[model samples]
Target: MKHKEYRRVVTGHNAEGTAIIESDQMASQMLERPNRPGVRLTNFWLTDQTPAEYDGPTETCTGDFILHPPQHGSVFRCVEFMPEDPEVMARLSSEDGANAFAEMGAGANIVQGGRHPWMHRTDSVDYGIVMNGEIWMLMDNEEDDVLLKAGDVVVQRGTNHAWANRGTEPCTIMFVLIDGVTQAGGGKGIPPR
Candidate 1:
């Protein structure tokens, strides 16, 4: 289940008012799920607030990947899911694996009181681009699952959903999550299914 390494290029303005490449290297902020060994996440960039002009070198963001989005700004990340069999999916949904996933920072009962282990909702509008392979986007009810292929884009509003890659190859998707509030309750939490 080896995946390609992701490279990130960051730019900034130098003190002499010149544009400079702040960083050009592989993304280091990566997390791997122990239970689902093939699940990999790489956080590229995060902004805690609206960005202002920078007069110094790029500062390392100290944000952690929470199940929720940033309160005021956004986060850009990429996820890779290796092809798995039914047995692997069963393991992922197992109680032990689910608990481990929650401990790994997934939202708590974020989707209808945690009825589904991988189904969770965040308080953000997400723009997702399928970078490689194909995957399925499963909604709360599971009736509207959509298959997306490379180059496909999905606008994921604040909703309870999960991603599944049932193909034979790995799937990669880049997502940008922007803070948002649900209109019904004017809160960051989505309504229960």
Candidate 2:
């Protein structure tokens, strides 16, 4: 269950030794907690290094973030890391997102990472559930901001957002998504996605 060299544009760092439990069936469900329903997972694994990948044009990102494509472009996950600076986060979430150029939308979520990190997409709706660690949902739109513990869920839409990892340790989550644009600037790389 250790994955090495896992890289994904949607991910900020890479995970190693992943143990995925593919099944939306009752088996994957934690029926013990009705408040926290079971989740349908596809690719789940483990990793050692977790952080922002500094490969982009900034120094806030580093680590091995990977995205695996199912046969025939089915759908998958993308993880990312943001700096401690809100200003930097804003820049990355804006038209000049230094970390990414992809237009993510629909079927997305925060699977793992820091606490209170901002999540969004330009063309995809997100669905996220915390696997380990803790996080706080910024609550974009007219929703009440909520804190996500070990077992919390979040659903976000295509908009401008950011995340704040307010934990002594790195925060992590498990999310599922599909149908998203992987290009910046109208998905054609013309500038502005």
- Angstrom error of the Cα, residue 170, model 2: value is 1.2
Look at candidate 1 and give me any clashing residue pairs: none
Q: How high is each candidate's TM-score? A: 0.84, 0.39
Report the Cα lDDT for candidate 1: 0.73
lDDT of 2 by residue, 1-193 (tens): 1112233222233245354332222111111111111211233322222232233331212233223222122223423222244544443323332223222222233312312232443344456676655655554442755666767777654444544554543445555533244356455322323
Which regions of candidate 2 fall more than 4 Å away from where they truly are? Answer: 1-74, 78-99, 102-119, 141-143, 157-160, 180-193
Candidate 2 lDDT score at position 52? 20
Clashes of each: 0, 55
Q: Can you write out model 1's per-residue Cα lDDT over 46-80, one digit (the tens) per residue?
A: 76676633444364445555544567778788889
What does the lDDT read for residue 18 in candidate 2? 55
